[model samples]
Target: MSVNVITYDVGTTGIKTCIFEISDTIKLITAAVEGYQLYIEENGGAEQDLKEIWNAMCSTTIKVIDNSKISPGSIQGISFCSQMQGLVLVDKNGEPVRRLMSYMDQRARRELKEGMGNGLKISGVNFLKLLKSIKITGAVAASVKDPVWKYNWVKRNEPENFKRVHKWLDVKEYLIFKCTGNFIMTKDSAFGTMLFDIRKGKNCFSSKMCKLLGVNMEHLPQIAGCSDKVGLLTEKAAVQLHLKAGTPVFGGGGDASLIGVGAGAVSMGSTHIYSGTSGWVSTVVNKRVLDITSMIASIIGADDNSYNYFAELETAGKCLEWVKNHLALDEINIYLQKICVSDSLESLYVNLYDFMLEEIKNIPAGSHGVIFTPWLHGNRCPFEDSLARGMFFNISLETGKRDLIHAVMEGICYHLRWQLEAQRKKIKTSKAIRFVGGGALSPLTCQTMSDILGCEIETVDSPQNAGALGAAVIVAVGLGILERMEDADKLIKVKEVYVPNTANKEIHDRNFIVFKSLYKNNKRAFRIINK
Candidate 1:
């Protein structure tokens, strides 16, 4: 009999669940979910209600199971793939002490500066520098201080909620606690908290950090790997989720690492590109390959042995959506239709994106003396400048919408290329790139990536749900249905490969040169504006 596996991706925007049949070959039976909204406040503070998030997860799980024809009794295990670095506080009775502090939340920025003293400069940037300075070593690091810093901020400010607090947990661990009545953290999720030491695969919190922040490490849950079974689902949780009691709950990793698995980018040389709300260029490394220049080495996989060098440029698809909503709302479908209408010829309809692409395509390899910096959401890897803003240099009235569009695309690709180039210096071999997420659906974008990166981009048959599928892979592995993760990888198939056109490569090369200089010229200007 085939084992039925259910996996959940607890994301910032919403909760997604997938049900898969695990036999000789893993098969996706059904996958669906509902979404939740994020609560944003003043000063770059973003948060989510834990109760609503958990309810959404449970509701989605129940919905998937209720809609499925397969019996729930056959489910062997359930696992999770969650957003990394969000902090949640709970009391002794397992009640929330405060609103969950999302990774995007910058309230900790003030605390980070105060804790770091005169050495700290800016808000977010200084926080990262202070994290590096502490040099905490472990697979996971729970900054008793950082969380407390944010927690105390809430206490001093909010007052009402702070007094009610008891224990603090990462979002993933908190979700597990809700389902299985267990408090545990995964290495992958823990590593992203800036509390963990990348050098050593352990959870080492510093006394100095603890003293400054006044947080006790004991309040944090024990840490484990993605494959490890955290606990069995309780009767209440099983009933609510429409699953059998005692189903194994596996500790899952961060979405990025699992995405690597979903894209079959698990082994060394395997590269995966996920372009959704944000865009990322990620590759798995057999060993830790740190890029001093880019700061791109992140532990992506559940296993401690491997690392994920991920570089991201925010607002790829989001930017396009912005354009569609603002500039070309009326002719959106017409533009989409034009993309498929002409296989042999260029599109006739001048959709905002197509118009942009055409101009970009015409502007030689590097946007023809035109350079665009895609710092729409600031920046993360390769350049961790929050003050960084978008720029277009060497522009003339001749620069059309097409030129601007292509510049945006090329600028994002340039950021990815910079990270990849850094990775190449550390890792001798890299594999063909696999494209996943909503952005992968765009043939033009895929081809453009190939043209710029000089590598074929392969996309899985189902790209949008790679993260959920990866969570399913974890369930399959935990249930002993698959002997190894690579077995799961083999069963996972790619739908198409977008090979790079040699002709377009030369054009992108010229544009890339100018793209690099745009940032150099505007870096000071960006800081000045921020100041």
Candidate 2:
């Protein structure tokens, strides 16, 4: 029998609720998104209101169910995957004690330095600390974004609130608690905390590491496997979400881990690239691995027995949004006024993204020698530099607005290429990489990435919903509807394939060389400028 499931993808920018029909193939019946604000401050503060996030999740779930015209009783399971490394503290009542510190937040830099001391910094942990972390956890990032640092930030800065905390939950665990009334953390989510022993034979929270961070063991949530059935949806949560009471709720995973499963990259060496508000390239691997120099490491995969080697980029499609808000004044004014100049103009404003994609199509490759660096937010992988800033290089008098736009898109691809090479150093990535995220919506960008990487790229249906689909697949596996996570390979349907354009190979290769050199030449200067 076929099963329908609701998979909530709680992302950095918003929450996307996707309803899937899991049968011979997984089909997205419908989806709805509700956005919430990330309270970002100039002093490296990025936070989200937990109450607002929960409300968005409830509302979007209802919207998706109503829009899909599906019966709530027909839904067999519900699960979730969310942005990783966020620190969410909750009291005994399972209510958030404070606004969440986002994975993007860097306010804990000072604390991270204190804990790890000054050494060759990669992922927050220094050389000595990283070796220790690798010996225990299989991965470690000492960045301010790591949950442990965020926890310390709270302990030092918000002691009153921290003292009231009953449990430490990542975004996914909080959502799971809301649905199932179970305070459980998935193994994949635990990986982001830098507190888990990610070693293949010992994937559990490390008590020694907790002591190192001066954290109480009781504050951590109970760890569960990704496919473990935590509990059933409580009657209270079901009423709010308009779903059937007692539906099985499975522990999903961290967004990066689930994205691999969602894109059917569960097999070893299979690779996938995701571009959302943030971006990453993840490959499934047989065992744990860590590359401190490249700032890439194997985090826990959705499959309990495996790992996902991932490289992160702080911004991807978000760069386009930056352009829309700052560079596209005319487009913004039209949007603000809601004025219709013509029927086509109305359509253009309504679907400005489609218009942008069409514009990108007309622009030729290489952006006529203009190169853009997509580091609007400091980079995370392939070299962790918080000071790196985005730039447009090799611009000339002949460069047009279209060239600038195309260059920005190309810049993101270049960053992805850099990340890919870093991961390639540790593992054998698949020749054909799967693409999933908002960026995959653009045929031009997909093709550009193919040419830039000199490899084949595959995008699947509703690519941006990969995280959601992966969550549902996890639920299915937990409920015995599917035999294993690998069954996802048969369920995922590819939308299109983009092959390398040999015609643009020479120019892109040259541009990539310049891209790598740009960073090496500017590292010291970046620190000076940002400092």
Clashes of 2: 5
Find the 10 residues in a row with the least total lDDT in model 1: 137-146
lDDT of 2 at 136: 90
Residue 412 local lDDT, model 2: 92
- What is the per-residue lDDT of model 2 for residues 438-479, given as tens digits with 9 covering 90 to 100? 888888889999999999999998788889989988988988
> Any residue pairs clashing in model 2, and if so which?
123-141, 123-142, 124-142, 124-143, 125-142
Give Cα distance to truth, residue 295, candidate 1, Å.
2.6
Candidate number achieving the greatest TM-score relative to the actual structure: 2
lDDT of 1 by residue, 65-156 (tens): 87887777878888887776677878877888767887656455555545554454433334454445445532212222234556556756
Candidate 2 local distance difference test against the native: 0.85
Per-residue lDDT of 208 in model 1: 46
TM-score of every candidate: 0.82, 0.95
Identify the runs in model 1 with alpha carbons over 4 angstroms from their true place.
Answer: 116-135, 138-160, 197-214, 330-372, 391-407
